[model samples]
Each structure stands twice: as C-alpha cells, then as structure tokens.
Target: MARFNHNKHHSSTTKLVFLISCAGLLGAALIADFLWASSSSAAPAYLSIASSWALEKSGILVVQNVTHNIAHHKREDVKDRKERIPERFLPATFADLPAPELQWEEMPSAPVPRLDGAAIQIKNLLYVFAGYGTLDYVHSHVDIYNFTSNTWGGRFDMPKEMGHSHLGVVTDGRYIYVVSGQYGPQCRGPTARTFVLDTETKKWRSMLPLPAPRYAPATQLWRGRLHVMGGSKENRHTPGLEHWSIAVKDGKALEKQWRTETPIPRGGPHRACVVVNDQLFVIGGQEGDFMAKPGSPIFKCSRRLEVVYADVYMLDDEKKWKVLPPMPKPNSHIECAWVIVNNSIIITGGTTEKHPVNKRMILVGEVFKFHLDSLTWSVIGKLPFRVKTTLAGFWDGWLYFTSGQRDRGPDNPQPRKVIGDMWRTKLRL
Candidate 1:
C-alpha cells in the first residue's frame, strides 16, 4: 500500500466516482438491449404464398406479408418477457419440399391479400368466398381467377361479412353455398345463417338457417345435396358433436335439415370430416378440454404427423354411425386438406395436440389416405410447413390450404393465423 496526501486523496475520489457512473450507464444499456431483442423475437407476422404453381421439378411461389402482432409485443415490460412472448415465424423456408418433382410459379403482385375462405372451380373460373382476412371478415368481396386466360379479373360485393375460420363451402355447378361459420377475431364462435351465390346471375341470396349454428365444420357435395359435419359450437374450452345436411335445386333453395346422426363415443375437439364414394367419414380431434376439464388433454401443439384415430364413423347402414378401423393417426383441424383422389379419400397436413398433461402446442407430421371402404389410413406425404389441419381442402386434383388457429398445447392458443398463403398440392392420382 502507498501513503496518500489530502490533495491526492480528493483527486482519486473524484476519478473513482466518474468511473462508477460510466459503468452503471453501460450496464443499463445492455439490459435494455436484451429486453428489446426478446420482445422482437415474440412478434408474430402474417405469411402466405401470393400464388403457388409447379415449376419444372420444384415448387416456386411468391410469398407476401399480410398482418402482424407488433402491438401485442409492446405490452410486456422487461421482466414479463420471460412468462409471455410472441411468436415470429419469419424467413420462411420451402426446402422441406421434394426437389425435382413439384415446383411453384412466380406471381406478379397480388391486388389484395386474404385467407381462411373457400375456392370453388366453376368451368374455367375460380371463385373465392367468405373467409377471415388480414382485416375483419372478408365479405362484400368476391374474386374470380380464370384458368383459361391465366389471369384474375372478376370481383363482386358480398351482402354481409361472415368471418368464418373453417366453415364448409361447395359449388353445385350453378351456385356456391357457404354455410356454418364463426364470426369474431378469434374465429371460435358459431354463425347461424347460410349464404348462396349464383354463378350466372352474380347475385347473392340467403337460405334456411342451421339448427345448432356451428362453425368450421366439414362439408361436401353428395347425391346432389350438401353434407356437413364436425366443427365446434362453443369456445375452445367446450366441444360439440353434431351433423347436418341440405338439399339444393336449380340455383335455388329446396330444403334444409339437421340431424344428430352419431354422437362420438367420446367427443373430441377440432374434429375433421371428409367424403369419398358417397360416404362421409369423421376423424381425429381432442377428447376433452384440457384447460377447463379435469383430465389430461390429448393434443398440445399441432403435430405434423397423424396417427391413431379415437373413433372412425361412416354415415351409412341405416344412417347409423358404424365404427370402421381407426385411423393410423388421430388429428384435429384435418378435414380441409382431404380430397377425393381416384375415388379414394386422400387426407394430408393436419396437426395432433400433445395430450394436455404437458400443456404445450407443437407442430407435428402430415398424414393422409383413410380408405372408406377398407377402413384404414395410409400416409401419402407431409407438408413443408406446419399448418392448422382445419385449413385445407381439395379442388381439381390440387390440395388448397389456408391459415387457422393452431393448437399450441397448453402454453399458448397460438393463432395459426388467418393468412392468404394459398398452397395447391398438385397430385397425379
């Protein structure tokens, strides 16, 4: 140690104070940086394929920015970041797709970006109807894509906006029928009324209301009539099991009816239904509400792989629900990717929630092929990205999909997003 003089001691004290202050400032800045980075990572953005088409062997498509959740990120302070964080799935990838087999085409620019609706192919035209868009309900806006001209040109106004997340839609060669949708930001509730549009007249009309008023149900054309099944009538904490049917004639309403065909032995959440060979089958959903119910929840995050259906039911044999062989994968939000390929029901890209015992939402595998006749499921292939199983459908041998609420186990009710990324899985079968 060295001795210090009074004058020297005073000078040293001043220098030490200055150094301490500088260190404090630098520490504060580092903490601020950490907080900012954590918040930025949580912000969610809208992702969609503006237009998807096949290239020589790979799939090429233009992706667009639709909507995001920057506001939700600002609510948390530095400490709150640990408990609650937003999700940003950016810098998307398409490398998961098989190379030298399927590809996508580049689009110029989209006039408007939308998602969570139905696309009906009429003659050479593709008509899009009510769906949850980047904004509120995507109503009063009808878009027509002409395959012959290889361009998009027609637009019509809808009477009212019914922002349904996963409702059923079907075209009867003359009119397009949209029925049973949910209306709200969350897309969890149910809508009562049905909307119809005449392709030739370009006019819209209303039809008889559904008895129970369900949304996100699966529907298809069978025997010149429309069949609807599954979907939820209550919140995510509650589950509903019901089926409905409607008959149409000459672009006009003929009859409307609802029936409780078969109550699922053990009702599940987010049930998926599809039709093949004049027979409709219901598959994969949660067994009970994990958040409110007093039991282990089945699904956590939506898994990309599908396996082990709880119960498989067929709508035939005296209209009684018959139990077919169970699906290889049990899934929820699955009906949309299902299509009839060569008289067989080809299903794809649905998610399974991990049993709620863990309480987390994750992305799983893609499964397809539930033979209605033989009562079995086979894997076709998987999707490059994880999607809500409910946001897919079959149109003209191509599988089309939209954005929806993906089950993120119990950690978060992750919004799969009401995106406009329209993907078409062009198949040879």
Candidate 2:
C-alpha cells in the first residue's frame, strides 16, 4: 500500500502538465478566431456578453488588446498607401471645373415701349410705371406684368399730378413711393410733388413734397427713412449736392419737415442707389445734365456737355459718406438698372462715357457686379446688345431686363432704338 515509484510519479506529473498546456493553447486559438470574426461583423449579443465576462474573469483582456492593435496597424497601412498615391491620377471634380456659359431667353414684350421708366417687382408681378413713350410722351398709365403667365395683366392710370419722367421710385413690398421728377417731357422742370401708390388698392396718396425738385435723383429707403440725394435742379443742368431724408413708415412720411443729412461727395443724376447690409451706396452718374433752352416758351431741353464718373460713395451706420472703389468704367442711366444678388449688386445696361473719337454716347452691354464684402467691381457677362436706361428685375435666380434704349447691333455705337422686348437669363451666382 505504501510503495513509492519516483520515475512513475514524474511521468504522471509530466503528462498532466502537457494536457493543461494543450488546453490553454486551444482556448487562445478559439479566442483569436472569435475576435477576427467579431471584427468583420457583429457577434451574437449573448456571445459578446459571455466573452466580455470571461475575459474580465480570466484576465485575458490583453489578448483582445493585442488583436485590436493588429487590426489598427492594418488600417494604418491602408491609409498610408492611399496617402502615397499621386494626385494627378485622381479624377477631376466639379469644383475644379469652370462655370457653365450663361444663356438668355426672350420673354413677352411690354405693352408700351418706354425708357427711364421705374420697374418694381412685387412677388410674381412687375409694375412698370411712368416712362417716356413714343413721340416724347410721358406715359401716365402703369403697366402690370404677370411674370408667372409671361403676359401683361393690364394697365392703370397714375395720379394726374404725378411726374412722368426721371421719377425716383422705390417699393417697400406693399407700397410704391414715387419721388421728385420732371412732370412732363423734353426735360421739363422737375416737380416737388411726391406720391405713394397702394399696390393692393391701386390708389395714390400724396406724401410731403421734396424740399426742392430733382430730376433723376438717387432715391432709396434706408432704416425706416426715405433718402433723396443728388439730381438735376430746375434748370435740368445743375447737379444738386443736397441730401435730404424724412422718417417714413408704410407709405407716409412721419416727419413734417425733411431732415438735411450729409451731402454726397460727388453729386449727379441717373446714379444707381442701393441699400445693402444697412448701408446706402451711390454708384455711376453724370455730373452735368440736359439743360433747357434759355428763351424757349415750352422750355425745351437740350443735351449739354456732360462728364460721366465711375466714383462710388457709401453711407454707413455712422451716417458718414465713405468713398468706395470706383466702378470699372464710368456709368450712368442706371436709376432702375441695378439688382441685388447675394452679396453683390449686379447692374445690367447703363450709359458709359462717350466715345473719344466721335463723341457719341457709349452704352454698356456687359453686366457689372459690385461685391459688397470685397468692395470690388467685376465684369460678369454681357447683354445680347448694348443698352441704356434699362429697367432691371431679379426673381427666382433669373435676371430680367425690359424696356430700354438698345443699340443697333454689336458693332453699332449709338443706342437709338427703344425696345419693349423683355429678356431674362439665369444667374448662377
């Protein structure tokens, strides 16, 4: 019963140790396979829970950590390979390409052929007001165009006393404000009478008259105030430097008297006035204007030697006029030819400096963009033909211009033809 064999006992112990080692290796192999499979796809919920618990209890988390490290290294290797590839082999992306060419489409023409008319767009309707029509007649009727239907809806008569040309028109969505302008044709003396029209009711109400009459004045609404700036005087030849404003709400003036503000640096008429980011900007105008014959009974106006300027001035929150970068070229007759697109003000057709050789009026056909952020100017594109006094409107990413004096052709320098034809182009920017 007490017989002790050293060799036999040693052999039994060795066999037990070998079996234990084999079992440990087998368990490790199973864990490695499970880890690999789990990494590729989701494991069963119960299996995941059991494995987590077993790892914690058996202190085998180091194995899982090692497996995770190997997978991380493999991912790093793939990323490194991608990074080493040359960029020239990659396919070109849309952002790397140039913008597509813009195409223009012809739309229905306006009922009346006019120039220097004020166009204000309200929703789908474009209201074209008093302009110089055929035979030098000032149109007193308002033409309503439904852009959705691409047709002229109808016409309505303006107030009998309302001025016909050089009228500074601005709309506050519901009401259309018509400021000082020549009451009749042939550069007649301007009228101080100011009128506001209720677009919904198609009725006109008289507002406080301007302190002084102005022809083609730069007028715009800013911060609940109606601002009326430089324009031609009663003689129609002198540029008024006076800047005036009156507190206005809805279509009526709140103050009894017009308040005088800082005068514009350079006074002129037919300038493009716009309010952007609470700032008022005046761009591209002429210093001189057409003058009336001294002894004429009807006071017929005659074209005077005028100088067009590219100067740009801005009135900021400080209420001080700051000189901005001038336009790329001298421009005028842009009273109603400008539209705001994003951060830039795009001006369509307008008058530029006269030709140096022939001294004939030069019309601008290229669309000009004034970036508000950068305070820079750029030539974006050109109109089908050169034009001046163009009434411009923007809606649904489309830029529309109608009723302007158009040039004969691309080679022609004179813009003698007044067109009622409407044209529109999709604006990418």
Which has the greatest lDDT? Answer: 2
Worst 10 residues of 1 by lDDT: 45-54
Please give the lDDT score for candidate 2.
0.81
The local distance difference test score of model 1 is 0.54
- Candidate 1 per-residue lDDT over residues 1-429, each given as its tens digit: 245587789899999999999999999988976676566354222121211222212433233222333433245566655654333221122112222233323332223444445566676676665555553344446677664454557787766655444456777778887776756533334577777888899888887767766655656666666666655555433445666666677655566455445554544445556555667677666543322222315212122222224467776746677777765545655545555666667655554544232334434445466655566666666554455543444555555544443333422333344444445556664
TM-score of each: 0.60, 0.75
| C-alpha lDDT of all candidate models, in order | 0.54, 0.81
Positional deviation of residue 48's Cα in model 2 after best superposition, in angstroms: 97
Q: In model 2, which regions exceed 4 Å deviation?
A: 1-101
Point out the worst 10-residue segment of candidate 2 by lDDT: 87-96
Cα displacement (Å) at residue 192, model 1: 1.1
